[model samples]
Target: MNRAPGDGLSAGEVARRLGVAVTTLRSWHRRYGLGPDQHEAHHHRRYTRQDLSRLEVMCRLTGEGMPAADAARAALTVHPLESVERPRTGSALSARAGGGNTIPVGGAGPEARGLARAAMRLDVATMSSVITRMIGARGVVHTWDHLLRPVLAGVGERHAAGGGLVEVEHLLSRTISETFAAVPRPAGAPTPRTLLASADEEQHTLPVEALAAALAERGHRSLMLGARVPPGALAAVVGRVGPTVVVLWSQAPATAAAGQLNGLRGTPLVVAAGPGWPRDGLPPSAARPASLGEALDLTLRWLPTAG
Candidate 1:
């Protein structure tokens, strides 16, 4: 049920609904004079519906990659009661799932559309909050295949066509990497038996990171050798650590040499994941997973004790 009009929300509640930190809320308030008007001196501020409406506009504007001060100026101009509605139960950013103006997420769900919007704005906070929430609710594997990939693919498509959104692509990659890195690896899990790495000269590491987070969700710990490991260096690590399974990812044809697979001939199982690998030349030492789920399944087969 909705609270009465006189009722007000605290800064913490406003921050939670807005998909931003309380510290960020406070910063906006201090920097832009956007704080609650209902409070008198010395008492804590309680945001009224009007205040909530203004902040909602603020979030939407800022999320479109606007300068904070300018967004605040625009938000302040919004008429009270005009934009205020029943605030959604989850993060306010979820309310923006309808905007398909900038990024082309092509027939993907509201969540994917919402994510693509955040990516275009380079709105790191909303993107990260949405991604973390989805991963927690849906598990990492499903989140990767469903939410993340669709947006990433759309970003790629847009980039390929117009040569724009370079900033969006880079920001999205960094945000995904940071979010996946935060996924909790199981405690007291056996020493990591799976090693994940990108093929030599390969700069695309997001897929590898997704597999690592997915493994973590299943109560298995895996070692990550992120991005562009030289063939000799990868071989040296394999020999020293002796992982039961190793997964190598390559995202482009230039980075997919058959020899990278050959370097790990002694490992019990090696996964040559990603489309980068040539169809015919994979050494018997490595197997290719058709998707993220398959990579997890293939790795778990080698490390049967994985939780």
Candidate 2:
């Protein structure tokens, strides 16, 4: 016998210590056979120390972004001390979490590792939930710089190396766009004085979107023209709306046409953002923002704070 009934812990107390709900405890029991092993005829079942240990493993793994089913399986099987993180043999999570299809999130925290695993499996709910939770906890800039960028770059590099994982890349991008676009905007915000768009024929737009979301978090508004606006079109928009500042993003050298900045020279502030811009060809009027924070700072200088 692991422990006498007198020494067993209650479900309510276990849940409180684990920072999860009692219902969650019940569900784990119903699903994964993780309920208290100690039972008596007259008294309700109570969890033993070993039970708590397994539940802790489950919670830790799930918190690190492992799916609930896999976490539960790992919880039931692994040695509490030495093998908790390693999922059981033939588990999908074991392969997906560390196998050949992994995304390289160099030196990032557990959250990034979890996010990468979820991304590789194309688990949209886990990916979205992890991203939204991180953004809510640390704000957009931190989440983007620390979490999203590494995974995105990893996926890109992997695809470039062998032209594989294109599906993973597209799914992750769409999920990011949907999540970033969901960042709440200020109510009754003034007309946007800042413009954001990708460079001509440049399809990559997530970095610019990050700047937009960061601005939104600070109660600022910007005209998000989205990806691949031709120079002439940007000029037309500038001529008509006349944004105080416009940010053009170029992710590769091929799209960083210096000519794109030429049309918007009349705009009061033209920010040539992203790595695509040529070192020597930017117009003297074009301001170069080195990071998302710098772009945000530059845009804020042109617009009043929104309520």
Candidate 3:
């Protein structure tokens, strides 16, 4: 059973967080019986917050020349509460507790993951409840990074694997994308004139809207071209907008369309984001964004470089 206040940390997690070898932690647990407090029926080991803290302190003390036994004793004697912890009520931290550090969907917390599950199961009311609660509580960006992004990524994967039923995937994508665009941007930001388009046959534009939002947030302007844009049209938009960068999204499993980007060489910054980016055969005309976060970084970089 997970003792009150905290769930058990897996053995691997404990070792990684404490900067110790798995073997070393296991040996200490065996020799000094300093292991975590719970072992479920499946033989999965879990440790409390207190247990992890104790281990951390023990490791710190031992690193500073204290003996292992002495370190262990000191660790067991101290218990510092997490900042997110509320006294009296004693509720544990939410999964989104540690800002920017998102736990995986399978891990704890119901807010975002629950919304995702509900959406996947086509439970409309539950999905609405979760999203409304999140927006009411933490605002849009928080919901985006901490919840929406993960959920979309999950949905996309499930859709690929024949998991998204009927029109669920399209509905979820449109709803989330439109919601993102609806969130008000701060007034008179950069507003840089730029075109947002997806390459030929690359129908995924979720990343495009996301990239546009990020750019808008930073004061650069964007013109959303949406999905399935051809290269000639893309080049024309660049000429019309005179944007510092022309952001493109592709999720088609191959960069064959990327070859068409040759028309955009020196006219504008050519940035590409999606799951379909080539690992080895990318042309120099386009840059690959490793993740949404990375895409944001690249956009920021383009701002200063923009004429």
lDDT per residue (tens digit) for residues 247-274 in model 1:
9998989999988888788899989999
Task: Count steric clashes of candidate 3.
Answer: 7
lDDT of 3 by residue, 157-224 (tens): 66666553446666667666765575555565555556678877777787777777666555565778
In terms of lDDT, the best-performing candidate is: 2
Clash number for every model?
0, 0, 7
For residue 149, model 3's alpha carbon misses the true position, in angstroms, by: 3.2
TM for every model, in the order presented, reads 0.72, 0.72, 0.57
Q: Which ten residues in a row have the lowest lDDT in candidate 3?
A: 93-102
**How much does each candidate deviate from the true structure in C-alpha RMSD?**
10.2, 10.9, 13.9
User: Candidate 2 has what TM-score?
Assistant: 0.72
Residue lDDT tens for model 2, 169-233: 98889989988999998778888888999999999999989988999999987789888899999
Clashing pairs in 1: none
Which residue pairs in candidate 2 have backbone atoms (N, alpha carbon, C) closer than 3 angstroms, thus clashing? none
lDDT of prediction 2:
0.80
